[model samples]
Target: MSNEHTTITESLAKVATRANELCNTVDAQIDNIKNTLKAEQDALQAKKTQFDAQAASSISQYQGKMDDFIESGDNRYQKALSKGDVIVPVNLKHLDDSKFYPVTLYHCKMLDVRVERYVHDDVSGGGILDYFVQLQNWSNGGDFTFAKQFHHSYSGRAFVGKISAASTPYTSSIWLRGGWSYKFYLNGHYSKGPVVIESETQVVERIASTDYFLAPITEVQPHVAANNFILGV
Candidate 1:
């Protein structure tokens, strides 16, 4: 009886050991499947990030190119007065009035004029100099009005502005787009009056981003010295 009982106990131990071995093998397989899925997910995420970065770069590059194209087109289409050439529009009635409730030129295009000046003179036998940037709106089978609505500009002018109001003599020359700000004066003397309405670096009003472009002007002193700065037209 003792021998039989011992034999039965040994058989049961073997069965339990075999079951444990099978369970461990199954667990290992499950771990392998989990690791494989995780690696695949990580690879997909990396590819997505790379693709998104490339797409963003492409968009930025194209946007810059488009802007350049617009600027170049505007330069050619707008009829501006060349150096040493005195020009005026022939059709006076079609011209828009300068100053007070300024209107946008036809076709949603604005006449951009920039102006800056520095001059000095004594209160005796005096001399004064003025500078200006003049532009004309060429007929596109319609509007023939010139853009003269700026500082020290007249009825036939479309775009103009005063550049500086500093008390110093300055040489007259083309003041390009740099170190300048547009000040819309609301009131009195000495550069800008007592009240300055608004100051801006650029006046960018357009039909979307690809239409009109603006530019600046000018002049002399009372024992005069001044630099009135503006960008307009």
Candidate 2:
């Protein structure tokens, strides 16, 4: 009887050891699965963040282009100037038969005139210059009224502005698009219009009357000095 009992106790001990070993194996497997699921969740979150950033950048670019389009279309002038949205003055001059020969010049920052992109050039001494419109030599009866609006580029943005005829009842309407100044000539006259300056750069001598070269009779001296500093039209 003692031998039989001892044998039964040994058998029970073996069964209990096997059951504990099986439980330990199951616990290890459960821990591994939890770790794998956590890793996968972290990876998915990273991918989502990357996709969101790319989507935001794309939206910003599209919105920027749309803003440029709408800005170019806004016109201060009542009349449409040209078939082209913005006018670039190549070598514009007037005909002999016209009452007043109209010549329009777009004083640009040079790099701003690209059709695909408006590039700004900050090269030293590479500044504003007169760009006169040149009519097609063959299109004789064509009028100068088309090349009216001028577009300017600054701070990597394209801005549309206008220079209209002062002959009408209008008050020589002008638009300032974050620039130091703009120069124009009407019927062989220079400095007849006002020189707009950023209020900060404006000096009392800039708009005062002076006998400087290219200074208009009606222009204040302070503006003439400003034109001199910027080099006149």
What tens digits encode model 1's per-residue C-alpha lDDT throughout 33-59? 999999999999999999999999999
Task: Predict model 1's lDDT versus the native.
Answer: 0.35
lDDT of 2 at 212: 16
- Deviation in Å, model 2, residue 32 alpha carbon: 0.7
Span of ten consecutive residues with least summed lDDT in model 1: 165-174
lDDT of 2 by residue, 8-72 (tens): 99999999999999999999999999999999999999999999999999999999888876776
TM-score, predicted candidate 1 vs. hidden true structure: 0.30
Candidate 2 vs. true structure, TM-score: 0.33
The root-mean-square deviation over C-alpha atoms between each candidate and the true structure, in angstroms, is: 19.1, 17.9
Q: lDDT for every model?
A: 0.35, 0.35
Q: Which stretches in model 2 have alpha-carbon errors above 4 Å?
A: 73-233
